[model samples]
Target: MSLPMLRASRALSGADMHAESHAGAYADSCSSAGRVVARGAFARFATTLALTGALFASLVASPAVDAKTAQPKPVLDASAVATPDRYAADAAQQMFAAGGNAVDAAVAIAFTLAVTYPDAGNIGGGGFMTVYMDGKPYFLDYREKAPQSATRDMYLDDKGNVIKGMSLVGHRAVAVPGTVDGMWEAQKRFGKLKWKQVLAPAIKYATDGFPVEPWLQKRREFAAQNFGGKTNFDAYFSNLKAGVVFRQPELAQTLTRIASDGGREFYEGQTADLIARQMYGHGLLTKSDLVQYKAVWRQPVTASWNGYQIVTAPPPSSGGIGLIQLLKMKADLKPQFDGVELNSEPYIHLVSQIEDRVFADRQQYMGDPDSYRVPVDKLIDDAYLAKRVEDITPDEVPGAVPVKPGLGDSMPEKAQTTHFSVVDKWGNAVSNTYTLNGPFGSGVVVDGGGFVLNDEMDDFEIKAGVANQFGVTSGDVNTIAPGRRPLSSMAPTILTKDGKVSLVIGTPGGSRIFTSIFQVMTNLYDFNMPPADALAAMRFHHQLLPQKTIYFEPYHPIDGELAEQLKTRGYTLQGQTFNGDVQMIRIDGTTPQPAADPRGVGVGRVIQ
Candidate 1:
């Protein structure tokens, strides 16, 4: 057990305020004007200082790293990233500028993110992607699956009851990996760059070294508790706990091998051998399973929302179904509005109703299309959508009413994953979402792999109402079966108008991501708000699981009777969780305006 060296990148302005007098210098100095006499002078000084502070905070929190050093010039060009860190973005951007299409760039960047930011995402995670080309769109479904040896009752307890499956630690909690194979397959088909070139950045970051972003550091600190005190994990976290930078040399070397050999190197080469050995020695992964693992690249689902055609990942990616389904429901209501109106009851009511129906469908029949017989077309059909919308009136009921959602029948929950979106100069766009299912992804980093493996297979319903590791339960629709892709909410979405891309967008908020982006797009096109304002607008989420409507305060940003109009709709509201990270680019004619969500350290780069 050894601590890999780390590189923590940061620029500190001294330290936390210790002495009040000096605190005034860094703090109140920013706005700490007291009754320093002339009293009136204080007000003016305070205002100026406050403004200065705001400017400083703006830059510090800005997604675009200040031109501080010779780090690397960004060439992402209207590229927005929501990966765990900047290194991921850099690796991705560098690839894009080097002639790699979004496919090449994204795969490069994603591997870097997995290695550098392993707490929330990594190679251990599996992902979903949506690609658009010519006049059509395609959904790339390379979601992770259970090992062939995995059983319907593998997650069951002593009483033959299904316990929360893969949310915890150890090999038995693992799901067969699909990320490497998925990335390789996508890049080979759509990327302009060669597999070796596309993989170079991630390989280098892993093999050589890169600085750890503050966010990565913080996540480690929190995750340290969960890792317990295993010698290897202890060595890993002790460095992170003390603010020491950590890197993944072993993982990098493994990635380098994969880059040269492709997914085969990971699943069937030395890496797969290593993973299988660990699984067999520690719990259950079989060599046959590793050898059989391969990535899937399929067509994405398309939907029309208010005249604009949208594209997203399909089944195996419930995100596509859920995203389009909810929009279809919303469009059915025919709610009309001009300009921004956040948290207004009518707006909230309409969105909530649509969300409720969409989620109900998700619960019923959204899973891997191969194993499950999902009437995806029926689920997302306008006729069925209109029927569901007709079920809702101007009332706020408990949402428990049995809404008969069409689409054949139910499927189990798809494995969870993460998302990323990219648009380069060729007018080509890629919207992607990848995940390890949850933070730390079963909390098991593949030994010498420097990445966590996804427990996505646990997303299936081993039993009706059986809770997963995250304390979330699965329904009949999300139950598992052989060769089935589980349901998911990681939506890599986009909107095009006039045959030009209007918005390259997506987010990562479990079931809530659908509504969050839905609101953002509605705000931009339907309401005509500026990019920043549209992003800042208050939002709401309806998952239909707990059945209570959730609304962020900012969703109702405008004041006056609009607020009153909302309350009359019988809305059950709460404070905004505000965790969704949405990145988008709006094409205003021939130009592009890029905006990244302020929820974290996201940067949107324009080619100009």
Candidate 2:
């Protein structure tokens, strides 16, 4: 079938898409005070009074009834949460109802996803968190670390060639996880509820079981086919089917231990031993590595664009820096995009040109700051960005601007990462994105730990210039080394206006994460679209390596005219499914407006 024909058949109008996306949402808005008023009845009475001049004048002269005196207002004005699953969203609401804040809700949601959305929400994986509290921005780096026995060429053949799939599958692919530690650290620092209080819901779900959704059931079938006898995957996940309740008693026990004894139980206690045993002869991780694992609190990367502040994850994630560059470059070259309509042929071309350059810089200069001395300041400098786009023009494609790192000498980061955005009534917000590198991680479930371990080893550059599973490449700055963190594309971002959080947003799409975020930001801030329309809008991605290729979501294919124009400009147009699963919340006044990506079966709820 032709591309245009397919688009016409499948593409939904903005209003239809928004309605369909939120059809499964738990609630549009809920008031906790339990008081209900009939606005329609009040309006009818007011209309009747208007018909009688004397009565209307008398009513207008009297003071209006004080709502507070008539009925007590709810303790919380408003709060919101958006996640990739309905179960996780419900868990977050549970924490909020218990007097917990955004941090507590986030911790609860993450643990709940470990049981319900195992594809990416995992306790055995690692990721970054960007927090905004009390007008200050903070970043947490709990990304998985390479084990002590890791080497520069651990995934290479003796003949010096790359060993395909070695870094992607099996026990050898596992890395020391950091999610449990990360959650613990976040709660200890900012959470209001007790640790056990936040974990109660996840334990209940795992012990009693929840019905499997279609997405999760498909993942189970895939795991059975690909990892049937490779590990203990089948023993744990093979029996799950759509519409059936799936329980994990072993995982419940593990969560129970961690809740009772604290995060230490997962590191220095019995859970650590189970992980060590799982990797006994097939992997390099050990009990010692687990004992030494610590999630670090890092300074968030912050930059100002127009009037808003962009606070996002810093290196080892190339996202924060890369996002800053994309915005600044677009701002610098504003004249080129002045008259171009958004998503129009000219606008996409200009954006793609800027994206290609930023990604080229990402490949050469991004990595774990702890391992490499990344030249962050030099890379995102205003002068440097201006020079990078000096040659860009609107009418024609510029000859190859050398695809090299912008700085003469620089330092330095996929999909399956799940993101959830939360906001409490107090205005505190948390944007978190974590992953296991791929679905079900390395497909190796620990004997007693009962969770999948991350194959984050594949995130490192197995060989400089060679693409990993996500088609993203990196330089020597990201080579494997003991205790070193791998470069990541997980960009958990928060935008603040006038020192107050205005938006909380992030997504999971491996290499497409940051770019997807970039587009959503433009859709909201630049085009002034509603939150639902912004999230439901079609998206595009352009990484540097694939020459002149640009990928768009297959379900929301590009317009025929736009596609033809892009092709005419020496660009290759590719349609790929599932561009991103973006979970976002925009704070309008004191109310939080939440929107979940229509592409995924997620939920967004507003609590009043």
Candidate 3:
């Protein structure tokens, strides 16, 4: 009989049999060598019969399955990595294949990105790393610190007015880098591979060159146009083009030195001399600043939310407090969202309102904990957040002027950042978000280092209450101070369920980082959407200062009716070209399902 007819015949014959009976029959068919030849035929027949029964049962049980049920089953028994670039993902997979744990893969990915994705990934920039290992959470704060010469009003003029572009492009804009030290510290503490092994892929890419993708090409063109002839930027990046091999011999040498001498090479060795020399006359950083820069291990900001344990970046990053507060407020107001469809008019309005409140609190209360007292515990207190959101109404939107910081205490770090998530077979996970603050940060490449320095000085509040390039305003708590880390929005987060890593996720979008993460979490837990759909879902952002305006992604435009409904409720709907690039992995029963944001040229790989 034909295959279809055979399947149909089995389906009919097994119509009255229980699924257990089919399983028993299949086992019986494989019970002896005499039945070996018939194994294939019996197996096929049993599988067909089982599937037909399952389909019929499902159809009869629920005619209209929700998105959660309709989604494909999670990939089983595999490790995964999700990153903003294909090459970085491949590098991470190589480490995994070589018997590396999550930390090793993470360290490998970080270094590789410095070579393949230089716009944000950098040895000269710094960011946060959240790691879950040995049933514990750890946060590494290698965020760039202000130079010792940095002062509160350094970016201001004789007239006390803020100078435009002073803090965005030049040697003066660069902060002391900590990425090399951060990676080294993480590897030393948790990695299973040798430091040289972790950095091999990056050195290979830098030495052998990698293909210039469209995103890197665009960044190079932009740098050339705006920062041409400014410094070594033009000398190095001016010639790179798309679809060509872009090699950085100087960078390869620097990476090799770093691999050989360890992270100290960048902070105290010849690399430090090169950086100090590059900034000597025109900038604030000195070799002393580089030498003093140290990546700190801080306790991760953690909370329990809806049965999942949240582990994320602590102070210096407003992300952890912001995320916890948002989640808390959402939970407190859960009753108001009953019957509202996800991403509907009411849903967007409610979420935006909650976000605005959090942003308000962030502006007033968040800062580098070492330099200023950030009341993290008080900021995320359920009672404080309750009071912060108690005034919200479904129909009326609050004006920006009226939204003051709930507790007077005060932060954007930049959207031009990159994030990656990794998971290994042993269940350890890492969510890392690093940045240069702006594209090709500071637009100042080290003369011999061939790496971009961060424009993170712009992240500090150059002038309190004044909006920065990303339109996020902050207060005095975030003002610059010597050796202080700027308040950051980079929240690399991990979530655990029942003591196992459930989610490893993070993204790059200046002021929108935490909100983007919050929304994704809600999508996964609240809406029960699969990882892929949850990531691809439309995203909107509100920073409270943009005042009554809700920024939605143009790529995922709001429905006409929903937009009109939101407008009728006093919201100014604005479309931003991009919201965020979220790289995440969802672990379901020890299997990982990786999802890369569709908005960028990223890849999500499942490693067998």
Candidate 4:
């Protein structure tokens, strides 16, 4: 099963708590690390909201934060393969130049970033991948599964209630990793490039080192305490210095092994032994667990919204079902989806109501199929979905959002994750989201080798009501069980028109993953905005529990006093600079226009 779907919970608003620290505490260190703001936090709104004292005061005292320096974009036409991040793009370009097709290029890009971009994706983590080739979608079950020792009660206390908080810090939280086999089997099925060729880009970055982008460098500083301590920090963060370039020799070496020998090295060879030994030291994983790893392939799920077919990450991952449910709830409303306007309160409110109603079902009925029988079809059946929408009151008040009675009140989780997208010239598109729960996952570095183990165990539903790293919650549908894959908010997707591929997309944000995809789709297919403008826009999100919209001021302002007014109705308010890295490719029937999210330190370019 995928990692246990422990619910996500909002981390402490670290808003007011970290405001001073964000500006002062890390200023010197960030500057030293070559980290610039990348982009300043968006401006604050003028409102008499209860949180106004803190919100307005911070803005009044601060100048706009510095934006990160912009990297150059590829000046090209549509046929060049488009990837969300630069390393992935470079990897694909190498394959394309070597006479490899999009499938080979994409595989190369995915493997390359697995070494270079480790915050969210890599061998430590696993996810679903949909290949658009052979004129049909081929679903691969690469999602991770629970261990042989896991059981239905793994996450339950004697009384059966979920243990509190993120399942991150311990050994019990991990599931068998399937990423290696998933990628290998995928290449066998569709990749055109030789295995070693696909692995080269990652090998180069890991060995020679890739410069730290502002966002990645900033994350290291913000979450330094979490990713590493004074001990063994260099193993994962080698050659990195503020304003100084860093290289990943260890990771490059690991990739070289995989490229030449295959993923078995990570599961059965010396590298695998290194990982097992480390896990044993930490009391978290065992060799038996790694030996049992296998990838499963399942069908992708879809729902039609105004003639456009939206495909998403399916079960094991609750995202696909969750997204359809939310859209179902709002199916009747005539949204002002004209792509030209900035995000609005009505948009935020509708999404919140949809979230509130759908979460109840998600918590009760979803889980890894190998262990639990989720009523997927019924859950997404139009009739059931319509009822979910009916629960919406169309008002911004707290209780107006619906929840299924008897299910415990919902919570949220927020783990940092990564996303990548690829669209080959042949029209096969792949959107993927992967994560290790937190930075430098588990912080259990492989001795004498590069790459950190995943703290994905924290991704389980350990404690019932407490917020984990990401604000999320989990219960029966997502509780840990042997062989069960945890529920996830990772919603990688593709949008199609008349049964043909139209656009491919994916992003990085824990609980916000759902909202980010939802909004982006609205902006594109519904709002009809251009790639860059759609990406640069701000966003707002609400998971049933917070009860209030979490707004990014610059783009999602409530307009008028509705935001301030919502406070009296029990809405919890919080704000942040723009978040979510949405990398997408639009095949407008004639050409492909790729857009990379400016909010993150990712690079996406057309393959020359």
Candidate 5:
């Protein structure tokens, strides 16, 4: 086993290490009447000295065994967390400071985001989390499930024709949420903090009110535009105003109940009752559905690329498997990026072809593992990935080549999700991505729960060979069934080198999540870029079934002469808005370097 090498990017200050001592220098040296207040002076001096002594003591306590230089940057010597919201990151940092491991911090971040980032971060939604505890990896699948009444053609009309937006919008769209149970389960099994303590920050944020960011307001307006006249729309948006304090009293109360009773309250108690009542005449979820819902534990999908072992969510989430497959293919092709210029024509074209090839397999082979036989072993096989790479061309674009799903001589995976990464002082690491499916998720809030319901039912393949919103088409493997989890693109991944988690990366974009995480991984490992540069780098996405074009972000420097170069080669290029808000934490040497996606308004915090 080897340790990570550190890079000098920023410096840490003495005051940043200890604030009380700096302030104590100006404290009252003597009290009024001048009784020679030696006791008070000595107490304050002693306190300051102790605080400073501990600061240095902690540094000396750890050997910095991984440090290459005589002295390493202090900034890289601390625990850190990164999330899509400042409040949520703060919650995670607080947990870490309170002697919590990555799992505990993750639970805190999960609940805090539900309150602060309502558009995607949610308790009403569900997702997959990959946890690395003591160097061993585990996966928790809390993906939202189809209701018991769900059927293969539930979203189809009489003639077996798929309903366009039927599964995306109303009460029927809501699934039995598993996020609450998922968080509780992870915390109970691997967390170091009490369940209630982990949820306290979120409860306080919801009840005491949090300032509405511009992004949240924009999302609110977007929801209103699409679902203005829908039932309960006003209830969730009545007090939503930009740049003002937005309080979720109902959500706060619900959180309070969950805190006191553990996650059981959400699954079978008051919150579930409210959800049932809200869907009584409109949705398919019954009290029984809620009570029966449970988050299952799955072994994490594993693969290797560039000396790094990868652990990620499996099966129901095609993201991880897809990423591993893509990386393997890239490694086989070994396309040199000419000084790592990712925007170069050969690099972009080769990578896009790889994406198209994998996605073609994804549309046909992936589904919930418990519901069907998924050829996970065969899909990630080196020979299979090498064969998939052969379909790609180094110079010309591989325009929509029909790549068949590999058989292990067996078989093969789609989000409006939120993702966060946490690495505590301990070696424990967590990468999680959860969501409500769409912007406001079904555009309905429970009557008294003050939470959005996930329309995850739409994630299923409504009909064979038809692409959903994320553009991945599926067969019966992903067809709706009672208690079955739909295919998803929520890829929460951890990369370990020599048995130590080196990088935790994930993102939120329906289909883009897979490509986004893949890009960042390549950027860091293959290209050897820093975490921030890796995330800030311009990205492109390709889905095989739809368009067969590589969608480039607007920020990509491929206009004018460079853009025209690709046009002559039959490369279908489409310039579009940015895709995927990725969150990453890189454990370098003795420090944790966290970086939030620059494309989003999220924040990263290094625990001091």
Candidate 6:
């Protein structure tokens, strides 16, 4: 069947909702990739939504956030891309210059990171992609999946106590990756440039070598401190340092093969063999596991607030749901914030309060829908949100009121992840958030493939009701299971005004991804700050557990009087600047204003 027809067929059959047994046999050949819009498909979908009007509003928009106001000055009308590293962004622009669309640029960007920013970027890790084409959205979940050998209590010891590093520090921590398949699917179905051309830039960098910046050097130092004596770390990163040229000749060879043979080479051919062989004695991965891995095309979760539509990656990622819940609660309680200063004690307290409560709900309910039913519908339900607001005792110190999660349950560390935003002149935009799970990722580089493996296994709930290293509490919903995708806080989001793409944003801060993205959006759309200011603004975060403690970025604007007020209200404050780096692009009219967050060494620019 043709790509769109295939998508329609799967959508109709409901088979695309989750993976089925024996699916690996035909998934790659038929359903794993390709959702290419058959010429008129997008138009049909758009018209259908327009015709349905308010009936589709629930699916398309939420009414909590205010509408975006008009920009005061004219902005550039051009394609733009941003990544946590400069070279990756340059590679994305190169793809755009080669006549690639946003999907192509994004694919190129993702691969380039694997070469240039080896700390977080990888062939072994996985992530989520939020794509917008002709004002419609598509979610591609390339997030890592557990191997067939994985079990729910694997992280627990014989005595049933959680093992501290079992899930975070070795070959066994690796999950079957889906990034290659995900990018391939995007390019095959929606890319405007040749796959080979898209892979060329990354291959060139990997083979020819690229200079390590101070940030990369710092990352190398940190990895050395933690994983110094390990064979895997020494092999791939021992020689890495600032000003030194870093090259991945083996990775270059691998990319060359992938560029010529397609991503199948990585999943089913020599590359897969290399990964399996290297991980054999230390982990459970096998060539069969690689063959069975598939990247699913999901539907983005959307919420309407402030006259604009917010579209983000859905579950297995609690980021979007938590975002929607927090914003909805904030909007529901707007009457209380009227005339209050943005970062004033009252305003800060309110946002923190919302974060605490929403995170509580997330810990109880959100997880991989294929493994468990994540009551997303009720979590974002209008009535339920209103009740959550009513339960909030805003004036009292937060912990004193004992705000608990409402009915229905949900569902660390400096994130060793990278995010990039790309918008093409054709009005196609993609926000991709991916990771290695830890800096250098289990510190295990695939033997001959020259790529680090992800420790995403640690992302699962090793101990029920306890918070993981990233300060995210978990339950059965997030427990590990064979073939199940683990929960992630990667919120790659796209915003639309009326019906056109307005903003694309994402970040990499483990549990802080959602809150960082949330703050940036509100700063731009709600508070009307420019893209730079929006991203550079000081940020604060509060997860539900370890109640009453609010973490803020260093020298955060809230201090003195505001800090005093927060303290008086029973909130404990802690500050740190390394929350997460947010890369964002504000698309107003003709130009896409891209902002690389200053918190990290990212760079942003428009591709002419």
Leading candidate by TM-score: 2
Q: lDDT per residue, candidate 3, 457-546, as tens digits?
A: 999999967887689876877888899899899999999988789999999999889999999999999999999899888888888876
TM-score of candidate 2 against the unseen true structure: 0.86
Q: Look at candidate 5 and tell me the lDDT of residue 133.
A: 85
Per-residue accuracy of model 6 over 1-608 as CA lDDT, tens digit each:
22334324422211111111000000110000011322143234233323433432231122211247331232337788878777777777666555566887788788888888787877778999999986688999999999999988888889999887778878888899888888888878887555666776675565446777787778778876776565466656666777776655556545655665677778987778888898888897788999999889988898888888989988899988988887788888888877877777788888877887788777777788787777777888989999888755457567776666787432310007889999888778999998888887777776556677888998988777767768787677788888889899999999888778888899999988988888887788678999999888878888877888888876355688778988988888887646888898888677789998888888888887
Clashes of each: 39, 4, 5, 59, 4, 23
Write down the lDDT of every candidate, Cα atoms only.
Answer: 0.58, 0.77, 0.77, 0.58, 0.73, 0.74
Minimum summed lDDT over a 10-residue window in model 2 is located at 24-33
User: Please, what are the lDDT tens digits per residue for candidate 4 over residues 1-608?
Assistant: 00111001101111221121110000001011111211021011111122434542343233231335332232224335444456667666656665555566656666666655655556766767766664576566676666666665565678877664224544555566667777778777776545655665564454334566666656555445654353344434543534545544444444545554566666765557766776675444667777777777778887777787878777777777777776665665544323323444455556666777666666666667666666677777887666555545445476653467222443222114666777665566777666666665555555534555565655556556644566677665566666667777777787778766787787767667777877777666566788877777767777766545454545455545767655655666677544578888877765777788876656656554
Per-candidate TM equals: 0.79, 0.86, 0.85, 0.79, 0.85, 0.85
Please identify which of the two predictions, 2 or 6, would achieve the higher lDDT against the true structure. Answer: 2
Looking at model 4, report the run of 10 residues with the lowest lDDT sum: 21-30
Q: For residues 1-608, what per-residue lDDT tens digits would candidate 2 score against the true structure?
A: 22233224221111112111111111000000111222232234234323443532332222223334442223235889999888888878767766677888898888888877877778888999999987799999999999999999998898989997788778989998999999899989998666766776675565446787777778767755766477667666765678877655456556656665677778887778878998998999999999999999999988888799999988999988888898899999988988789888788888888888888888888888887777788778889999998877886463366556677643532106789999888888999999988888888887655678888999999987789998999888888989999999999999999888899999999988989999998899888999889988889888876878889897589858788888888888888867899999998877788999998988999965
Residue pairs in candidate 3 whose N, alpha carbon or C atoms collide under 3 angstroms: 364-410, 365-410, 366-410, 414-510, 415-510
lDDT string for model 1 (140-168, tens) is 66677776666666677889765543335
Give the deviation of candidate 2 from the true structure as CA RMSD: 15.0
Regions of candidate 2 where Cα sits further than 4 Å from its true position = 1-76, 226-228, 396-399, 409-415
Give the CA lDDT, 0 to 100, for residue 396 in model 6.
53
lDDT of 3 at 551: 87
Report the CA-based lDDT of candidate 3 relative to the real structure: 0.77
Model 5 per-residue lDDT at 201: 68
